[model samples]
Target: MNLAILDGGTHYHREAIYGDRYRSRFDRAIYAPDLVLADLEDVGLLIVPDRIDPVLLRRHRALLDDFLRRGRTLVVLGGNEAETWVPGVDWAFRPLNYWWWLDKDAVPVQQLVTPEHELFRHLPFADTIWHFHGILLPPTGAKALITVPGDPGNGDLGGALIYEDCVTTPGRLIISTLDPFYHHGSHFMPAATRFLDGFLNWARHIS
Candidate 1:
């Protein structure tokens, strides 16, 4: 399958990850006014990584909607207001706790709700344990692949960290609040590297 990445051109993390390391695996579709459907015509999978400008994505929302309607896959990473551009996706921001692991009795917030899913075959749940920037309140019929348990006291009905939505459009949508690319590309977070090793491999072979 032909894969492509939306390069926002404003982040070094994107350059290190998509441009340098996985250059041969994906074609770059620079984020600009010229990025039209023609640029994604032959692409089977389009990756919108973390840190992409939400305003730019909003400007091309129609193009993205059209891409999905054409039976193409779309994968979105974390750190943006996806609700602004992506149809049926509602995101809620949460405070970051980089030191969550510091607590000796800390429980991992990330949970693999679908342990039998094929994605786990490539990426073990442990590799997905890093902190998330927010949570996704996915639309009805979307599978919550990974979830964070709700906190009843705070009235926070915790939501999905990773979800797969096949009901939103003709094609598939795999989205996550986990920003592995940003962490891995920055030369930190070993788990992020592990996530990419498996995620990219799984992405390459998915139909």
Candidate 2:
């Protein structure tokens, strides 16, 4: 599938993570800082890194709204410490270097949170674990298939549906504050690869 990785404005670690996790699965996964809102085509899926600039956010918002209307999947990873053109998304994740999650017990990666959703196919639940800080949305029409319980430091809480079969007429919106792919790509490739397999499959299946 054709996918695009929009790095609104990123740091070093973010690049490393995207490279390790999503390097090959996509027919093409590019990292561009100058990408405009109107530059998007039928990219099937879009991964927006936390590098989004606030100044440009206003301009890109309309284009992104349009993209979601077309049934495209927009995945936002939480590794960044910047603003996103995509608004209203609340990301849940912990820093890889944070002391709160230093121990494995602090944040155990969940295999199955919402199995009923189509995003959980061929997933090696038992063998995989992920490190996420804060990646979550308001749960509007977007259905959250799975979620990691929240702790004082990290993890995501359950919310309303974020995806829609017929979003805004001809276009459908698939928004996810979950950045498992980003986390995996940055630190654990095996987990990231496993998650991407499911993530990509889910993106393609949505309207």
Candidate 3:
């Protein structure tokens, strides 16, 4: 499967994303323009990070929408440099890095929800991923994944949603607004192993 991480041209370098075993799992991980033209017909998922601009997004909206329309999945990450994605669908990483700790640490337990859901079935991820920087979860229908004091940058419960059993398309589609690639490959709790077990289990077979 061609898993593309939309980089929307931020200062965040392309090489920095290396070092994850998951890297090999992806037949190819690329950025915009190139990603836009790749045939999504055979692709399984698109994991975007702050990528979506009028030019690119407008050009590829049909491509992206068609992918989702066909039941494919899309994940978006948000932070300071996020401004390109379609607004209502986008969430912001609040003030603090809830998952990443600068001083203290938080415990991680499997607060699993929707186990029957295909994505979470037999997966290995705490109910809450170590929130380093997540979208400023909007104030509406987005589901609640993690509750807090709460952290300003809370990951939206709903934005992580995948419509698998809905219309003519029985496929799955998800849009996330946080960077869950285990940045720096630190393999720390709520960081590395914390999320890998779950996501990788049912991961689309990448060539």
Find the candidate with the highest TM-score and give its number.
1
**Which residues of candidate 1, in runs, are more than 4 Å off?**
18-20, 27-34
Give lDDT tens digits, candidate 2, residues 1-207. Answer: 366666543443355334644455444444454565545675777765533455554556777677776666666544343225554454444345424445757755443555665555654454335454444554344455444544546443433222323432344444543445444435544555566666655554542
lDDT of 3 by residue, 1-207 (tens): 555455444433242244444455455556676665445656777665433354766566656666766666665443423334333344434455553445556553224344555566634445335554434333344443433333237643422322122233334434444444434233334453445445544555331
TM-score of each: 0.92, 0.59, 0.58
- C-alpha lDDT values of all predictions: 0.83, 0.50, 0.46
| Residue lDDT tens for model 1, 55-134 | 88899999999989998999999976788888899988788899898899999978888998888889888999977898
> Which of the numbered candidates is closest to the native, going by highest lDDT?
1
Order of the predicted models by TM-score, top scorer first:
1, 2, 3
Q: Count the backbone clashes (under 3 Å) in each candidate.
A: 0, 28, 14
Candidate 1 TM-score to native: 0.92
